[model samples]
Target: SAVISQKPSRDICQRGTSLTIQCQVDSQVTMMFWYRQQPGQSLTLIATANQGSEATYESGFVIDKFPISRPNLTFSTLTVSNLSPEDSSIYLCSVAGSLSYEQYFGPGTRLTVT
Candidate 1:
């Protein structure tokens, strides 16, 4: 199992500002993903960051809005650009484990845009 941790567990920002959330795993993992959980809503995948390749974003999400970087196997970052009040949500970092169905998630970064 991989242990994941996110930085700036909670933050409050002004509208139009951007925040870069960091995800760090204790071990090298190949499949890392970013997700957003709006208040009272289920998780929505933002993108998948694979080492040495460009991050693949999910529908309704664009690379320009949520740019992701996977510089190596154990580290990744997601930057939310041009934030708005609607962008306030809990951002999570997930990783697929050795088993096909196993997945682990970080604590999550909670952002509030005003």
Candidate 2:
């Protein structure tokens, strides 16, 4: 099993501002993914961060809006740019496991744009 940790368990930000959330993993992983869980909605993959390469973001998430960086196998960061109330959601860090098809999540960085 793998474990992940995220900073700023929760925060309230103003519109047009930005917040960068950090993620750290306990062990090396082949794939590290970022997800967003909005209120009353399901989890959506924001991007995939692999070591030594540019992060691959999912549709609807552009590099300008949600820039991601994976400096090494163990650490990554996600920045929410030009924030809006619509961006208020639970941003999570996840890592793919060896056996399980599911990924493990951090407690999450809950962002509230007011």
Candidate 3:
């Protein structure tokens, strides 16, 4: 099992300002994923960051809006750019386990854009 921790557990940000969230894993991981959970909605995958390659953003998410960095196997960062009220959501970091279907998640970063 992997232990994941996210920084800035919760924050209140003004509209149009961006926030960068950090995710750290206790052990080295090959697959790290970023997700967003909007109010009253299910988790949506933002991107997948591998250790050596560029992150792959999901259909609705773009690199311009959500830039992800995977500097090494144990750390990654996701920055939400040009924030807006609708961007307020809980951002979560997750890593895949040995099993294909198994995943461990970090305590989410809750962002409230006012």
lDDT for each candidate structure = 0.96, 0.93, 0.96
TM-score of each: 0.98, 0.95, 0.98
- Per-residue lDDT tens digits for candidate 2, residues 1-114, read 777899989999999999999999999887888999999999999999988998998989899999999998889999999999999999999998886587888889999999
TM-score of 1: 0.98
Specify the poorest-scoring 10-residue window by lDDT in model 3.
8-17
Candidates ranked by lDDT, best first?
1, 3, 2
3-102: candidate 1 lDDT, tens digit per residue: 9999989999999999999999999999999999999999999999999999998989999999999999999999999999999999999999999578
Candidate 3 residue lDDT tens string, 1-114: 998999989999998889999999999999999999999999999999999999999999999999999999999999998899999999999999999689999999999999
- The C-alpha local distance difference test score for the whole of candidate 2 amounts to 0.93
Report per-prediction Cα RMSD to one decimal.
0.5, 1.0, 0.6
Worst 10 residues of 2 by lDDT: 98-107
